[model samples]
Target chain A: MTSQFPSTDDVILGPGDDAAVVAAPDGRTVATTDLLVEGRHFRREWSTARDVGHRAVAQNYADVVAMGARPTGLLIGFAAPADLPLAWAEEFTAGVREECALAGGAVVGGDMVGSDTLTIAVTALGDLEGRAPVRRDGARAGDVVAYTGHLGLSAAGLALLERGVDGPADCLSEHRRPSPPYAAGPEAAVLGATAMLDISDGLVQDLGHICRASGVRVDLESDALRPEPALLEAVRVLGAPAGNAVAAARRLMAVGGEDHALAAVFPPETGLPEHWHAVGVVAEAPRGSEEVPEHPVTLDGDVVERGGWDHFRRE
Target chain B: MTSQFPSTDDVILGPGDDAAVVAAPDGRTVATTDLLVEGRHFRREWSTARDVGHRAVAQNYADVVAMGARPTGLLIGFAAPADLPLAWAEEFTAGVREECALAGGAVVGGDMVGSDTLTIAVTALGDLEGRAPVRRDGARAGDVVAYTGHLGLSAAGLALLERGVDGPADCLSEHRRPSPPYAAGPEAAVLGATAMLDISDGLVQDLGHICRASGVRVDLESDALRPEPALLEAVRVLGAPAGNAVAAARRLMAVGGEDHALAAVFPPETGLPEHWHAVGVVAEAPRGSEEVPEHPVTLDGDVVERGGWDHFRRE
Candidate 1:
C-alpha cells in the first residue's frame, strides 16, 4: 500500500500510515462512496480489471463533481479471493491512477482484504473551492432543467450486449467506462445552477428524486430531450419493428441508467453552460388533480412509467 | 437514505445531495477506508449485523484517530443479496449510527448495491483541529514507547469462540465490537508525542512497522507488556499446562489483532498521559549485522516469530 501511492501536492500524508491527510483548503470536503460487485455490477468476462477500476472512480467522482466540487483525493478498498493474480491488482491500480489524473486528483490511500469474490469500493473526496454546495432540494418553479454528457448510450449499449448483438466498440465502452462531463458540474454551479445531481439511476428516476426533495414537478420536452447519435444507431440495429424506433429511443433516453450525466436546474434567465442542453422546466404540482395522474416527471404531457434500477428489486 | 441521516452540524450537506459536504475547519482532512466481507472479515453466524457494523466503524475510525484527528463524518457502501432481510439493513444502520455518535461523528451519506454475499465498506473523515498530524516515521532512538487500552483481550476472545468455551461476556464482546481508545490519539499529539499508530495488526507486528519506517529497533519489557487479568483468566481456563500460562499470555499479547489500541513514541522527559502505560523503548539497530537480525521487534531479548493476519496468505 505504501508503494502504491505516488506523492501528490494535495496529499499531506500518503498510504503507509494509519490514515492519509488531504488538503481541504476551502475548509470543507465533499465526499461520496460507491460499490461495484463482480457479476452484479460488472461481469469479469465483460470488463477488464482496468475498465472496472476506471468505472468505479468515474461514478464516484461524478457525485463529487455534481456537488460543484473539484476532486482532490480517493480512498479505495478491494476484496478478492487469495488466488487472484497480482497483475490484475496492478492493472486496476494503473486504471485508478489514470482516471484520477484525468479528473485532476490522486489515490492517496486504500485497503485490501480477502473475500470469496471480487469487490471494489471507492470513496472520493473533493474541494468545494469556497462555494456553497449545489444540493438537490434547491430546484424551484420556472427553473430550467438542463443536462450535459451522453444520455442513453449506456442503456442502449447494455441492451445490445444483453441481446448478444455485435455492436460498436464505443457503445460497449460507454457501458463499461462512462465518460462523465466532469468539468461541466462546477461550471454549471459557477453559472448559477440552483440545483444539481449526477444522473446515475436514469434521468427520469433521478429527476423524480430531485422533484420529491424540492417539492416541484418537472415536465420534459420530448423534442428537446433527443437521444444521442450512438443511441439512435443502436436503436436502428436493435430493429424492434418499423416505426418503433422513435418509441425505443424515447424509452432508452428516459430510463437508461449509468450515464453519469450532470443534471441541473437553473433560473430561466441564466444562460446554460456551454455543453449543457435544456430538456425540461420545473413547475408546481396541480392543486386539485384527483382525476389527473400525479407524477414527478412527465414527457410531453405523458407520464414516464418505466422505473430505473433498484438494487433490492427485480424488474 | 435521506431519512437515515439526522442533521448534524459538522455535516453541512447530507445524504440527499449528490455528495456530502463536511466541515474541515483546519484546511485538512484525515481519511481512511476499510472493507468487511462476510465469512472472511466477519461471519454471519458468529456476528450480528449490528456487531459487524460497529466493528467496521470502530476499526476505520481508529485509523483516523491515530493521525491525531477527530472523526467528523462517514460514508458507507453496503452490498448484499436482494433477499437479505430489511431488518438486517435497519439493524446495521442503527449500529453505524450508534458507533458514529459514540465517536462524535455522523453518517453523512451512503450507497447500497446488490451482490451475492454481504460486503460493507466505510470511509471515515476527520478534522485535525489545527494540529500537525502525527505520522509513523517520527520515532527516534530514546523515545519511550507507550500504549493505551487492551492488548490481548480480542485474541483471547477469539480463542474462546473458536474452542466453544464459555468465557466472560466482556471478552466475547471485545471480539465482536472493539472500543478503540479514540481520545488518546489527539491527547498524545497535544502532549508532544513524536509518533503514533493504532495497534490493529498485533503488537510485535505493528511495532515492526514503526521500526522499519523509523529505522529504529524496539525493545519491549516483558513485565511492562504483560496481558491484563482478563486475558490471564482466559489463559487459565484454556488449560495449557500449569507452567505455560505465562507463555500463553505472552503469545496472545504479541500476536493479537483487532485490539485497536493506540501506540506512540513520546519523549522520556514528558509526562505520560492518563490511561497510557510505558511498555518499551526505541533503540538504534545493532551494528555490523549483515542480515540486520531479520527482525525489528525484540520481546525480552528474543525475536517474536509468531505472525499476525495476512490478508492474501494462509498462516
Candidate 2:
C-alpha cells in the first residue's frame, strides 16, 4: 500500500519497506540507541507525547554528534497502549520529524507495538564524512576544556515546574525540549578536539566521565562556570526556594542532568570556535605513591561532592 | 572500566563507547527495529529472559534479511526494574550475542534504563553489497512463491504450552527460540528473486501484505502447504480439542505468528535454491471494471477468512 509518511533526501529507502536503506558516504556507520520509559524518564502528566518524542530524539542525536558524526537516519520503536489516541501518535511523529530536520537527519523507519505503559526507543545512525571519531579517552594533560550550549537551564526548569511557578517559565520549556549542540561536535572535530562528550549528565559529573576515561583530572574555573544571568533570573522568579539562589544555581549547574550540551578538550594552540566557552583545563592524575585527589572534577580548587543522577539508585 | 562482555569479529566497536562504528561496504545500510514488552509479547512465567532476548533479535534480523542484505550489527535498548537480578541482564545479553553470531552479526552497542516492567528494543543493520534491494512491490503475476524455515511450529508450540501438554514438545521449544534461515535471503536475492518478505505474521496474512504492496493476488496450494508431521503431532498431542487434528494443523500453518520464516517470489526461469519450498503462485488482480477480490490471499482457490494476530485488537 502507498505510505503517507514524508520522505527526505538522506533516506534512499523510507518506511513501509521491510527495512530502510540510507546513504553512507564514508564507508562506515556510527550508531547509538537509547530508551525512555514513562514514569522513569518521562511522565505522561508532565510531558505530552510530542514532548517525549522530541526529547528522545534530541538525546540520542546528541550521542551521535558527540562522536563527531552527522546524523543520517533514525529508527524508532514505540510501545503504547492500544487505547492511545491516534492524534497523540501523529503529534509524536511530527515532533520526531521536527527534531530530525533540525539535525539535518531523517526518520527512516520505525515500529509500533501495544503495551500497558508508554515506551520509546530511538536509534540514530550517522556518517563521519572522512573525519576521525572524537572519543572520550583522547584527552591529554594541559588541554583546554570547553563547552557549547546552555548548562543548568533544564534543571532550573524542573525546579520551576515542580514549584508550580506561574506565567512563562523558559526553564520548564527547556526541561521539556533540550536543544543539544549538534553542529558543534563536528566543528570541534574539524578544529582538532582532543576528546569530546555530550553533557547529558551535569557539567561536573559528565566531565568526571572524561577524566576517568582519559586518566586525567579536569579543573573548572569557578569564575568561568558561574551560573548565567538567565539562570539567576529563573532563581529570582522561583522566589529563592533554596534560601541562597547563587549557591542553588551553582549546585544545579554542577549536578543536574539532561542538558545534552557538547563538551570537548582541545590542544592549547588550537583556535577556539565562536560561541564555545573555555571553562576548564585538563591536568595529569597524581603520580604513583602520591595520594589520589578527593575529586576528579575540581571547581576553583574545591572538590565537588555532589554527583549526577543515577537511574539505578533507589531515590 | 574494563568490560566483562564477550567480543566478536563483526564488531568494529563495542559497548561502553558513546556510539559504535560498523562497516558498510556497499555504501548503504539497511535498518529495522522491533520492540517486545513483558506480558504483551512474552510471559515471564513461560519464556526465560534469555529466550526473550533471542526471539527479539531473531525477528528484527529477519527484516534486514528480507531486504536481501547481510546482517552486520545490532543496537539494543532494554528497560527493567532496578530490582531485576543482574543474572537476568547477563543472560539476556548472552542470548542476544548467541543469536547475532548465528546470523553472522554482532551486538555493537546498547542502553539500559530502570522501569517497572521489562522492555527490549532492537535495531538491526545490514549491508546489501551493491545488489538492488528486493522489495515487496516487485512481485509479478507469473512469479513462483517460496518460503524457507519452519511454518506452524511456533504456533503449535504455543498451543501445546497453553494446553499444558506433557512429553517431548519440540514445538514448545521452537516457540521459545526462533531460528530464521538468514543465509537463504542473500542467496535468494543472488538467484534473482522478485519480491521478498519475512513471515512473522503467518503465511496467508503476511502474504496478504505482499499482495497489497505488489498489487497482485497470491494463491497457495493446500498440497504444497501441508504442515510438517511434527506440527501435526503437536495437534494430536493436544487431543484435537477443536475437532480434526489435520485441519487444526493446516489452520495453524497458515495463520501462526512469530515464525520469522523467509518468503519470496521468483521468476519461473530462475532455479529455486535448496531449502526454499515452492508453495504458491502470484496472479493478476481483477480487471479495471471488475471489483477487487475480497481476499488478497487464496487457499486452494478459496479465499481465506481467518486473520492473523492483531496486537491492537481488544481480544
**Each prediction's TM-score versus the true structure:** 0.94, 0.93
Cα-based lDDT at residue B149, candidate 2: 91
Give the alpha-carbon lDDT of every model.
Answer: 0.83, 0.81
Model 1 per-residue lDDT tens digits across residues A7-83: 67888887889999999999999999889888888877777888888898999999989999998999999998899
Candidate 2, residue B107: the lDDT equals: 81
The sequence of per-residue lDDT tens digits that candidate 1 reaches over residues B1-315 is 436756678988777678989999999999999999888787777778888878988998999899999999998999898998998888888888788878878898888888887999999999999999998888888999989978878877777777777776666788898889888888999988888999888888888888877778889988887677787777777664577677777677777888898899998898986689898998877762222346788988788877422211212
Q: What is the TM-score of chain A alone in each candidate?
A: 0.93, 0.91
**Candidate 1: segments with Cα more than 4 A from true spot:** A240-247, A288-294, A307-315, B287-293, B307-315
Candidate 2 per-residue lDDT, tens place, A1-315, comes to 114346667788888878999988877889999998888888777777778778989999899999999999888898888898888888788778778778878888888888877889999999988898888888888999999987888877776666666423556767898889899989999999989888887888888878888888888886676777777777667565556767656666777778888899999998897778899899998872133355788988788776422211222
Candidate No. with top DockQ: 1
* Residue pairs in collision within model 1: none
Question: What level of docking quality does candidate 2 show?
Answer: medium
